[model samples]
Target: MRWRSTLVAAAVGAAALLAPVLVAPTASAHGWVTNPPSRQDHCSTGAVSFDCGGLQYEPQSVEAPKGSMQCSGGGGFTVLDDESLPWPRTQIDNSVTMRWQLKAQHATSTWEYFVDGVLHRTFDDHGAKPDAVVEHTVDNLPAGDHTILARWNVADTVNAFYACVDVTVGEGGGTTEPPVDPTDPPVEPGDCDVAAWDPAAVYVLGDRATVGGHTYEARWWTRGENPTTTGEWGAWRDLGAC
Candidate 1:
């Protein structure tokens, strides 16, 4: 009986020691830039409207180690590192307001912005948690086409989230489109009169909602997902701007 108890205790102790190693690491936070639209954002939102592999469905999953200059953070989404793709460059002034939509929030260490491989701006959180929406205004960016790499570092982990936004700064940049107003009436007549999208609303297949002056139809059951953020391969299909 004594020997049996000892063996059982040893096995239990060994299991406890191996527990942390056996479990896989996962991100405590997930997010992406949406205003100017990151690479994954464009893929998820149908702005680019092309196949973007798994990244299309998960714009917020680009997590890797804390220090990488690559757009994808050298993570599994290697397609983001490809510069040849027809990535849309948003036209903007020298100063731009960057916005991030966080699917999950964690204690943040710092938020970093790098422009064309140079560190441009940084917001240090000092191990504080963040809100669902985070915004920062970066000033004095040089003119012409440039890539801004944004990194969100978690306070307690070595991992960080990455988003790349392409922009043409100053005059003679890309075509500038006016911002959409949610209060504006539908531009197209017929079938555009739908309820506004509610993040709390549960939607089934074929359900429709209007958001950001656009209409979207749910392709499957979904909840808590913003219609504008869920790109082309997401649960909602774009019905064109209304």
Candidate 2:
């Protein structure tokens, strides 16, 4: 009886909390940063961004007020831009491709990338109906820890989609220390052989495999090669020699 009562109470509480969102208007905007990993991107991919919010469930819905290019859109998401917070930073090379996933194409004015408050590069899509997948390459960013803001300026509307990506530009591409709970029981790598890093296997971001008594997760899609022999750019990330 006690357990049932507790469960009922918890259910009621949760329903109450979600009541607003469940009844709220359907969101129209749909897009998010995909490469170099915006906060919402990290959450979408099963990685934690430290100070994340309920936006994890609806990353593409993070819409900011028009004319405000701020990260987090100005409210309920500014934590994404909160420098004081310990956001997970993905490692990348100085030159990286920034990509965005738009659920629907829009006439774009311009797409801009900014690093440390300085404009790095801009892709002019003025009057162009961009594809759902938008990409641009940014080069010459000095190697170091940095935050990037990718802004999508709409041609017709006064609004823009904003995403902040935390990064570390190192010599050999970059790496990301996933913010998995340290308190969770450590996962043990099985006896999978190092040969498990099959060259013919096509891997994608967030894919995991056990190899050589350690667990290695794929940072990006790869196939047909031994990553251990490759340099840091290898798509594999070693969990440890467990």
RMSD of each: 14.0, 18.6
TM-score for each of the candidates: 0.60, 0.58
User: Which digits, one per residue and each the tens of the lDDT, describe model 1 over residues 1-242?
Assistant: 99999999999999999999889586444899998889999999787856899887889999999999999899889999999899999989977889999998888888999999988767667676789998876766777999999999999988999999999998633223323335534434325689998765768877889988888887656665677775554556778877
Best candidate according to TM-score:
1
Number of backbone-clashing residue pairs for each candidate, in the order shown: 3, 7
Candidate 2 stretches greater than 4 Å from native: 1-25, 49-51, 66-69, 171-242
Candidate 2 clashing pairs? 91-174, 91-175, 92-174, 199-223, 199-224, 199-225, 200-224
What value of lDDT does candidate 2 attain over all alpha carbons?
0.70
Give me the displacement of residue 48 in model 2, in angstroms.
1.6
Q: Write the per-residue lDDT of candidate 2 for residues 49-145, one digit (tens) a residue.
A: 4646666676777676555556776756766766786677988876788889998677877777888767766655545687788777665566788
Model 1 local distance difference test score: 0.82
Cα lDDT listed for each candidate? 0.82, 0.70
Candidate 2: TM-score?
A: 0.58
